[model samples]
Target: MSEVEKRYLAAKERYAKIGVDTDEALKKLQEVKISMHCWQGDDVKGFLNPDGELTGGIMATGNYPGAAHTPEQLRSDLEKAFAMIPGKHKVNLHAIYVDTDEKVDLNTIEPKHFSKWVDWAKEQGLGLDFNPTFFSHPMFKDNYTLASPDKEVRDFWIEHGKRSRKIAEYFGKELGQTCINNFWMPDGMKDNPIDRLSPRKRLMEALDEIFEEKLDENYTQEAVESKLFGLGAEAYTVGSHEFYMGYGLTRDKLICLDAGHFHPTEFISNKLSSLALFSKGVMLHVSRPVRWDSDHVVLMDDELTEIGRELVRNDLLPITNIGLDFFDATINRIAAWVVGTRNTQKALLKAFLEPTDDLKKIELENDFTTRMVLTEELKDFPFGDIWNQFCELNGVPVGLDWLKEVREYEKNVLLNR
Candidate 1:
């Protein structure tokens, strides 16, 4: 047998002794598809206006050459990233990524503009998710959208939100998978506002107006995202966690919990179970935040492992939509995509390999000593062997072997750009 098979067989036997099935874990992990963000390929500079400066507290550091400049380039880069990433996955697109030659602003974008994306997705056997471009626009003046004091501004964004849902619906209908349309805008103030209620109320009303037309849930699901603060708007954000949580629960919408949008001490993993109680579903934006909302590439750190464990142990995978949300232009963008996505999959695999039933049984029986020992001991198990086997099974390069491929692509393709 091959080295991967031998290692996998030995690891399987070890896991079986603890009431865990390596095969079953791998099978389940295969079914979990993460929606990889497209912004990373081009540093959030979508095709709508490539020259437009990033605003609303958004920034991508580094002068990494060869960022995709057109729809074709972005899609090609995505194809390269997907080839290295194990398992089938979806591509997350912002409305700003619309592919068209026509002069159409965000206010007038339609599904036809994204037809190329739909065709590409069909050919690649991938799904598509979407988000409205509520930032880095001329309309985002004074750091407000959907909550702006100007009716013209709010109406324009509301129209964009409406069109975004239609585009998401089109994706789901064409690809045969539900598309999550998440709405997040940098709408807040730099200093303390005496009255936060007015803007929030306006935002609530504007969102209600946007959702006035109901779409098929089978084709599309809408999610509202919140942020603690932004660069220009640090004192108060209109869509606070509580605001969206309450709005989502009342309006029957999926709440998007971004990992980097919370406080330093706050963990999205801790919030999933609680929200699952009342909300029908949730959308996750997995990212790493150095301090504040720095939007660093995701690491296989404690928080990520905890997030994976919560999803696996509590059976929240069925009700959760997973997507990555980070833009790091410092390194090879394709490598960033591969590393972040594979780490996420690895975290999930690690969770699936856990003997959760046994641990829970021990905990329920008040066997804290055994529970603690087993949990810690499982950490030292042969997880890397299992991961390598998974990569081998999925027909992707195993371990650091994928990095070599990425570097080769960089040398041949990226350098030329």
Candidate 2:
């Protein structure tokens, strides 16, 4: 047997002794589909933009030389990145990335605009998730939509939301899988306003009108994502977590919890149980936030592992939808996706390899000292070997060998771009 196979055999036997089946862990990890965000490849600069500049509180900082210039390039780069990842995955798309020949305004977007994407996704054996872009358009210059004072502007946005749901349904029908349609808005104030209540009421009414036309639930699932704050709206966000949590429960929609959307001290791991109890399922936009809501690439941090553990232990994988949401233009764009995705996979693998059943039993028995020691000892297990074996089984490059592949892709394809 190969060195990796030999190492995995040793690790498997060791884990089995502790009542943790490494073979079953690897199998479970394979079933997880981390939804990759397409915006990372193009730095949030979609094709519809007149010029590739971000506005309306959306920002991707870095002048990376090899950013994908077109939808074709973005797909090519994503394919390279996906090839390096060792599991089934999906892609989340913003409406602005729709490929079309005509200038399709926000309210009039049809399934045809994204037909090519559906085709590409089918070819890759991938499902799709969607987001309606609510910022950076002339219609949102006043920094409000679905909560705007002007009836005309509010109605226009309502139409967009309704149409977006239709398109999402179409994607689901075409792909033969359920598609999650996420709705997030940048409607808030830079400074405190006198009439916060009025705007929120209007926002609720607008959302009511938007969801009035219910589509087929089997094809598409709807979710509302709430943000803590934005650049121009630091003082208040109309779609606060409280608002969306209640809204999600009442409306029977999934609540999307972004890691960076909460305060620095808040972790999504703790919030998952509360949401899973009420909402049908929770959607996750996993991003690394250093100090604020800056969309940094994900890493194998403590919180990521805990988040994975929370999902695995709670049996929430079937209900929870995990997706990446970050853009870093400073590094090679494809490499960013590869590294972030691999880290995320590694974290999940660690969670699965854990003796959570026994740990919980210890906690139940009030054996705190023993549980603590066991938890710390688990940190030094042969997790790397299991990960390597997983990559090998999935027919992907094992260990740092994938890093060499990414570097070669950058030099040959990205450098030329």
Give me the runs in candidate 1 sitting further than 4 Å from their true place. Answer: none
Cα RMSD of predicted structure 1: 0.6
Ten residues in sequence with the least summed lDDT for candidate 1? 57-66
Cα deviation at 276, candidate 2, in Å, is: 1.2
lDDT of each: 0.94, 0.89
Question: How far off is residue 307 in model 2, in Å?
Answer: 0.6
Q: List residue ranges in candidate 2 displaced over 4 A.
A: 50-52
Separate clash counts for every candidate: 0, 0
Q: Can you write out model 2's per-residue Cα lDDT over 221-274, one digit (the tens) per residue?
A: 999998888888889999999999989999999999998888888898999988
- Candidate 1 on 101-178: residue-level lDDT in tens? 999999999999999999999999999999999998999979998999999999999999999999999999999999
Please tell me which predicted candidate would have the highest lDDT against the true structure. Answer: 1
Maximum-TM-score candidate: 1
Instruction: State the lDDT at 335 in candidate 1.
Output: 94
